[model samples]
Target: MDNYARLKQVWIAVIYLLLLAIIIPWYWPEEDVRQFYGFPIWALLSLSGLFLTSCFTAWVCLGREVTKE
Candidate 1:
């Protein structure tokens, strides 16, 4: 596989991990962890990192040229 295809696969994996981080908590028993700025710590940190990483990935991907086979 070429670089573009590889990068797309990696991006999809990152998105899958992000979704897992967002949803896996629902199956766990509730516990009160220390809040970050009045929001759940996981939501604040995990989602912020996910969004930033996604933005950076998109920015980098925009400049790449995918050659046809």
Candidate 2:
């Protein structure tokens, strides 16, 4: 792999780490009870993060070039 490819992978990994952090509800307050669209706010936020991660992964996978070695 080249330097550019390594850098790209590092950036992708950072994004994924951010998504993972968002998906985890460790930051939400335990006693707070907020709701949105009938679901808990934290739950919705986690779900949204998950959806975004999925979309990002799909975009990356589908948009990547195919190389024959």
Whole-model Cα lDDT of every candidate shown, in order: 0.71, 0.96
Which residue ranges in model 1 land beyond 4 Å of their true spot? 2-29, 66-69
lDDT of 1 by residue, 1-69 (tens): 999889888987887677566644564347857687888876676677677667766876796788899
TM-score of 1: 0.45
Give the C-alpha lDDT of model 2: 0.96
Off by over 4 Å in 2: none
How close is every model to the real structure, measured as TM-score?
Answer: 0.45, 0.91
Say which candidate scores most in TM-score.
2
Tens digits of per-residue lDDT, candidate 2, 1-59, equal 99999999999999999999999999999997999888999999999999999999999
Query: How many steric clashes between backbone atoms does each model show?
Result: 0, 0
* lDDT for position 65 in model 1: 80
